[model samples]
Target chain A: MGEFELIRRFFDRGDRAADGVVKGIGDDCAVLAPTPGWQWLVSTDMLVEGRHFLSTVDPERLGHKALAVNLSDLAACGARPRAFFLALALPRADAKFLEGFARGLFALADAHGIALAGGDTTAGPLNVCITVMGEAPQGQVLLRSGARAGDELWVSGTLGDARLALEVFRGTHSLPGDQFVQVRRAMELPQPRLALGQALRGIASSAIDVSDGLGGDLGHVLKASGVGAEVYFNALPRSAILAGQDLMLQQQCLLAGGDDYELVFTAAPEHHEAVKDAGARTGTRVTRVGRIRTEPGLDVLDSDGAPMAVLLASFDHFKS
Target chain B: MGEFELIRRFFDRGDRAADGVVKGIGDDCAVLAPTPGWQWLVSTDMLVEGRHFLSTVDPERLGHKALAVNLSDLAACGARPRAFFLALALPRADAKFLEGFARGLFALADAHGIALAGGDTTAGPLNVCITVMGEAPQGQVLLRSGARAGDELWVSGTLGDARLALEVFRGTHSLPGDQFVQVRRAMELPQPRLALGQALRGIASSAIDVSDGLGGDLGHVLKASGVGAEVYFNALPRSAILAGQDLMLQQQCLLAGGDDYELVFTAAPEHHEAVKDAGARTGTRVTRVGRIRTEPGLDVLDSDGAPMAVLLASFDHFKS
Candidate 1:
């Protein structure tokens, strides 16, 4: 199939009635009418085969993960998903692959009420780059620089399951068939905490998505806000499969392994009940994992309140 | 170096003072404050190494072309340049390549006053995907669907030189050293017609950028507007080197040559002088090339006003 025909068949859905999308899909440029008082949020992510996912990954799940990663950025900023543009480079026009990929992609977009506004497609080695555009009210959008001393840090959902799945894939760890399936799902299909982020907009002082594991991503919030943190190592939440592992393995996965897609946020001590209320409203499990500190460096503390030393460096695509 | 350090050193510029940028580069998502009552325009383009340019092409030109192609889409919609997001995948982090690339990319961005907001970087085969965000007032943006049956077709600047340059590179044709340099520049560095597009917004009924050859790109406008057109074949503008070629070669290059990055648009006959004034105001060379008809297909007429037929198929990435 030709490029235009392929796009028309698979990607261009003509029934988009998205609120801010004045024009979608068929134009030289997609036109968006922004909500009057809202600030627009933009983010882009590029996923490559082998580097980002296994060659054997299901096309549907690949599609889901591509948009999921980009949406995670918006959720971290307390932005409501509005629309997205995809620029895809493929090896060929595989009909079966396109069908399953579109199905998985649009399913998540529909669930979030976000529209596939426009994109570009070409023949090349397989690559998926998604740029998501969203909106939040002015002065209400969350940022990394909002944290300060005396704020309590929190996280939504569990972490490390995705990394555990990766370890199994790498032959460094193994799990029973059913348990492997569970962790694999966590790695393949991540649900963005859009509602939890929106709910915590005013209550939380700062927020970030845990894409590069908790340690490295939290370091971003600290470096940006110029504040230190004290993470309670034992308080870090995990899946049952991970909790069953040894302490060192658990710390390795939970602290420095990548692709968690959970929100790490901070709020003042007085708003502890408010943060809990937000978690309840969004049906998310919010855990108090750390607190903002006046000092200038991170402290990962054990149950004894003493810092434990480990070189828990996160995954760096180039240097790793 | 790590991914964060790579981004900070190359892509992240801390001095962005663009009008509507609330936050840039460091946040989870770049925040943009849109101009009230103006509609936002978005477009994306992906350029792969072998497909889009020669592997030996300069890295600086590669960077410029990457963003330039996306900006062309916004120009076609008559939107003012605002900001862009880049998603880059590289085989390795070569510091020299990045420095030249950033220099060229930022030069054009500075010329257009667009900010490099936020994006992703990963290790893979080289790929550059850019998403540009622009703006035009509501109801003022030109669209392909706006052309009328009696409108006169127009094109800005020149066409076909880029293809001539490609022919030389492919060993299909040859040119003198000086002529080759001129045409090669056309292929390597295309200037998007931002000012002319904005100038023609109220005057032109429809507009499109000539990327996939004039014939195919014009087909999109005709298909969208539900109209046909008659091209004065001999009147199609060409560079001096292209004009010196034989008739058949000239016809192939002028009709179906891709990567011209020029604007093809339509305006009512009553606004001919106004169109000229817009061209003059923007310092662009605008030429009247054809007229839109109520009929359902495109017709290329010779100087004798007879339909002369030769296969002039435009470039399609997959099929070609």
Candidate 2:
């Protein structure tokens, strides 16, 4: 099949009306009619081999992860995803790879009511860049700069499942067949909490997506909002995959390993109930892992309320 | 310098007032204010190493040409250039390369009042993909499907200089330093006719940018508009660099060699005066090249009015 036909057949299955995308894939350009009283939010991220992902990962999962990360960004901003454009660079024109990738991408896109709008395909080393467009009501878009000193910090879903899954894939951990599958799925296909984000729009004071682990991502929110956070180590969400891991190793992995793609946000003390209620409506778990403080740096506390000693700093793209 | 500092010091020199761009580069995500009376025009193209470009071309020129080609797409649709986002895949963190590239990109962005909105950078083989956004009044976008049988065809600027420059670079032809410089510059920075595109909104029946050579691009218009064209060889614009080239080679290059980002359009005969006036205002020369015909394929005639046969087809990204 030709390139155009392949795209249409695999990536064009979704309810366009639900997404507010007047036009979807298969045109020189996609046309969008804006939602009334809403502002569009746009962000793009690219993943390259040896930088963002390993070559051994399933192609289908790679596709899902690429779009999921972008959606996570929209989730952080409390935007309802509308559509996306994908620019893919491949080493060769492999029909199988394209098929699986498009299938994976469209699965998530359809679930979230996002249409694949437009994209470019070219010959190059394997890379994927996804640009997601979303919408939020006027002045209701949450940012990373509204957190206050007394605000409570929260996270959707578990923190270190993806990192633990990575360890399993790296051969450092072993599990039974079913357990292995579950952990691997978590690493491969993370579900971005889009509905929860939209619900948290007015309630959350500041927000960011956990792409580069909790420590690094929260640092971005703190830096933007000009406040510090005190995370309770005992309150962190962990999976059964790390049940018997060494304490220091588990803590380090939870703090430093990246690729979680969950929403990390803050809410005022008075709005905590509302925030929790919002998550309940979306059927996603929300954990109160930390609190915003007047101090200007991150602090991790043990169960007894003593500050944990600092070790490694947050992940730096350039340095990493 | 850090990523944030590098961005501020380099890619932030363009005008931020371009239509539809409420917020530009340096933000978490760009905020675009959609035009009330316009339909947004968007297109993306990717250029990869050992494929779209050679290793020896100046880094600055690569940056300029990347954005210029997308601008050409806007020109084809009679849309005014607005804002663009870039996705770059680099092999390493080379500060010097980034500096040169950002400098060249901002140079054109500032001149055309286009804002650098947002982009992603990743580690990989050198690849650059630019997504450009433009705007045209509602229902006024000059698509490739509006040509009529009696419309006159026109072209902006000369063609084949960039192809000739490529030939020179490959050491297949030797020219004087001045001619070489001119041709090389043409290859590096073919200007997009933004003013002509805006002016052609109401006048041109159909239009397309001549990036895949005049033959292929014009063929697209013909296919889309379900019409034919008749070319007058004597009216074709030729640069001084082609003054003494072999007649057959010169004609072949002009028709089939790609990378000429000039506007090729068809308009009603009565709009001739307006076209000339638009050219004068924009300080870019425009000339009549051919006419739309009732036949279903292209026909080329020599200066003496006899049929001329095409010896070579135009460039194709996947095939060539």
Candidate 3:
């Protein structure tokens, strides 16, 4: 089996043609007829070897994380995924790796009801770039610039687990074998909060997925919405791995370490009930982590509500 | 400038927000509201260094060809270009190369009125992949399976120019400096037939863009349409580059040498007048190259009406 055969066997089994898709994987292009009254949302992300993932990372998990990250973008926009196109660059033709990768990719795609529409396979260093298209009602799509002063900020799921998982990978932390499996899995196979996002369509004022760490990604929402935020450090959801860490150190990791893939959104206080209803529907906990403020920059407050100063900020691909 | 700065300076110049685009560049995602009565067409292609193009090819042209090839897929479906997302993998950060590439990409994008929505950039071997989105009226998309028996086959623009240019690049052919510039330009920078495709929406029974050599790509259309074709050799458009080549050799080049982004389509005999009108409206010449037959295999005939045997075959990345 080659890459093409592997893709056909593992990833192309779904009947995408019946999903309002005029054309599917077997053509030069895929033709999609939009369901009436819905707008399309498109997002793309590229993951490169040695930069985005470790060379020895599990191929299945790599595939899952790749699609998961892009799905997170859709979640941020309050769009339900429809289909996706993948472009994979491999160093050489490896049937085993591709088979495993496709298996992992399709697992998530099927769960989200997104069909693998079209893609290109070529010879190069391993890079998986996925472009996802989703849909939502017109004028209902959430954006980063919709937040306003006095809005409440919330996050879905836990933060800093993926970052801690990386530390476990580097041997800086000694974790029990089963705990290691769970944490590493979280790092590799993140579940984008798709249901929560769809339910938040008119409820959340603004949103972004936390891929570049909470501090950096939330900073983007703040910058776009032209607002500041006051995050309560004690309210941050952290794994037990960070339970006993120094308060400031744990706060830094929660703020700066990335790969969470959780939805960070803001909503007017009047919609708090709707936010709670969305969380119940998705079976995920939504916590009030902060509030959108009129101030001009991020302010992190401790349990006692005193501002804490910090340095060694979050990851910036261009800054380093 | 770094990658982010370079992108902001060049690719972020156009404001597509006013063009019915809900979101443009520099966002977590782009939201597109589908124009009522139109379905979306999406396709993606990846070009890797040493696999797709030589390292010495002009960066500007490489960028143009990458987007144009994807646009050709949209043309094949008889859709109007709407928006595109690019994923670029580069070895190292080079501002000059990016500027030239963005300039070339935007030049064609502006001509077609397509918006640059969102994409990802990463560090790796040079790989350019573009996912293009287009739209056509509901149920009006021309698929490869729509051709019928006795349909007249047509191709837009000239053939074999890109193949001839590749020959020049390989140093196997020598030409006057002026012709060299023109041929080389054609090989590097292909103009996708977006306007012609939009006009051919209802006229062409079946269509495909000639990217994987005319013979191989046409074979796909035939397989899907469940028909064969009898192509006239002398009817094919030839350039000065093929002036002295043997008739059989030139025919093979036109048949199996790929990288020509022209549209090869079939129309019912009753729609011949309308097809011609489409060509005239788009300012592109359309030639009647062949006729679809009930028989299910390809046949090429010379002007003398004798079958022509050709040796050139389809280009496959894995096979190579």
Clashes of each: 0, 0, 0
Clashing pairs in 3: none
Model 3 per-residue lDDT tens digits across residues A21-124:
77777666788888889988999998988778999988988889899999999999989889899888887778788778887898998898888887888777
lDDT rank, highest first?
Answer: 1, 3, 2
Please identify which of the two predictions, 1 or 2, would achieve the higher lDDT against the true structure. Answer: 1
Candidate 2, residues B1-320, lDDT tens digits: the string is 54545556666654446566665664356667766666667777788887678888788998899989889888877787777888887777788999888878888877888888888776678889888878788778887888899999999989889888888887988889999899889889989888888888888988888877898789888987889998897788879777568877688668987888898999999999988888888887899999999899998888887779875477754455
lDDT of 3 by residue, B1-320 (tens): 46566568767765557465778776678878788888888999988878778998777888788899999999888888888998887777787898788888888888888889888877777788899998889889988888899999999998887777777777877678888888777788888998998899878998899987899889988988889889998898877677567666576569987888899999999999999999999998899999999998888888798888875477776666
The DockQ of predicted model 2 stands at 0.49
Error of 2 at B25 (Å): 4.3
**Pairs in steric clash, model 1:** none
- lDDT per residue for candidate 1 within B1-320, as digits (tens), equals 77888999999886446778889899889999999999999999999988998899899998899888889999999999988998889899999999989988998898888999888899999999999999999999999998899999999999999999999999999999999999999999999999999998889999999998999899999999999999999889999899999988888888899999999999999999999999999899999999999998888999999987955578888898
Isolated chain A: TM-score per model?
Answer: 0.99, 0.93, 0.95
In every candidate, what fraction of the native interface contacts is reproduced? 0.95, 0.40, 0.65
Per-candidate TM vs. native? Answer: 0.99, 0.93, 0.96
**Each prediction's RMSD to truth:** 0.9, 2.6, 1.9
